[model samples]
Target: MPARADFPYYDGRPVPITGRGWILLMLSVAGAFAALITIPAETFPATLVPASLFAGIPLLALAHLTKRHWTALFGPVGLKQVGQMFLFGILAIIASLAAGVTVYLLGSVAPNPAVAGMGAMSGTAFVLRLIPTIPQLLGEEILSILPFLAFLWLATTHLRLGRTTGIGVAIVSSSLLFAAAHLPTYDWHWVQSFGVIGTARVVLTLAYIWTRNLWVSTGAHVINDWSEFSFTFAASHVPIGTR
Candidate 1:
C-alpha cells in the first residue's frame, strides 16, 4: 500500500467517506443542479449564493469528518503556486480553444448558442456578465473536484481497482458528468456539450489530477472561460471591414 504522502494534496490524513456521505453528496449535487435550471435568470445571480452554500457546506463538513484539512483537499496556495496556476490556466485555455476549433472544423460542433449570445453583447455588458462567473466558476470546481476525489476513493477501496485504472475511471466519469451538466446551457447539443466541452473537462480534470490542487484546476477553468468570453466580446465590438 502506498503511504498517504504518495497521494496528491496529501497532508498525512485519512479521507474516508461513508455510504451516508455518498448519499449526501448526491443530494447536494442534485439540489444545486435543480436550482441552476429552475431559477429565473433575472434572479439567477442571487440564487447561486444559496445554491453554492447548499452544494459546498455539506462537502466541507464531509472533509472535516474525514479528517482532511482544507489544504489537503484544495492544496496550499502561495505566490509561487498562484504563478504556476496562471501558467496552467494558459495551457488550459490554449488546449480548450484548440479542441473547440478542431471540433468546429470537423463539423462535430455547431456554433455555440451561449457564446453567440455573448458575442452579441457590448464589451461593457460582457464584462458585467463575467463578474458573476468568477464565483460561479469556483462553485463549479467545488462540485466537480469533490465528486472526483470521492469517486476515486470508492473505486480504489470498494471496487479494488488498480490505482491507474481507478484514476482513469474517476477522471473520465466525472468529466462526462461535468459535460452532461452543461447540456441545458448548450441547448442540449451533444456535439457541443460532449464533444467540445467534454474534451475541455478532461483537460481540466487532468490538471487537478496532476497537481492535486483545486486552485490550479480552478485557475485553469477561469482562464479558459475568460479567454472564450474575451474572444466573443472582441468579436462583437470590432468593426467589420469590407472592401
Candidate 2:
C-alpha cells in the first residue's frame, strides 16, 4: 500500500522494486523465522539455540554476498565503529541497570512491590547466560531489516531515490513495518503500542548514523538482544510460547 515516492529518501535517481524481489525477501525471512524460532522450539526438533546462530550467521552472509551499501542497509561497522558501539552499549546497559534499581527501590518503599525476575549469580555463570538469547534477536532484527533494505535498494535502482533519502526512508518505513508486525505477536493495540517499536528503530537509526555502516548497528542490535535474552534465560522464560 505504501508508495515508493512517499519516502524522504527518494531522489531523481532510478531505483527498482519488482514483485519478484519482494516475494523473495518475504520468503527468505519467513523461512528464517520458521527455521530459527518455530521449528527448533517445536517438540519434533527440540534443539537449544540453533535459531540464533542459524539466523545471525546467515543474515550477515547475505548482506556481504549482495555487496550492497552496508551503511544504508544495516548501519556501520569498522574499527572506529566498534569503539562507538562499545561506548553506546555500555551506556545503554548502565542506564537500564540504573532504571531497574530505581524502580526496585521505589517499589520497596511503596506497597511492597511484587518481586519479579531478579536474582543474583556468580559473575562467570551470569555472563554465560547470554548464550540462550541470540536467536530471537537475530531472527527479528534480520526480518525487520532485510526486507526494507531490499525495497529501498530496488527503489533507488528503479525510481532514482537518492542515497541519503533512501536511508532515511528505509529507517522510517522499516520502523513502521516492525511496529505493525509486532502488534499481532505481542497482542497489543497497534495504535497505542507502536511507539515502543518506533523508539527501538530510532536507536538502530542512531547506530547507523554513529558509524555510517550496518555492521555496527548489527553488533549493537546483537548486544541489545543479549541483554534481553540474558534475563529471560535466567528466569527460564521462553516468550514465544516455548513451542
Q: Where in model 1 is the C-alpha error above 4 Å?
A: 1-12, 43-71, 241-243
Model 2 CA deviation exceeding 4 Å by range: 1-22, 40-50, 53-79, 87-129, 191-193, 209-213, 226-243
Best candidate per lDDT, number? 1
Task: Compose the digit string of candidate 2's lDDT tens values, residues 14-123.
Answer: 23334564565566676665565455352212334556644655455454434352223444346887887666555545544554455456543221011122224444
Backbone clashes in candidate 2 total 26
45 Cα displacement, candidate 1 (Å): 5.7
Query: TM-scores of all models?
Result: 0.82, 0.57
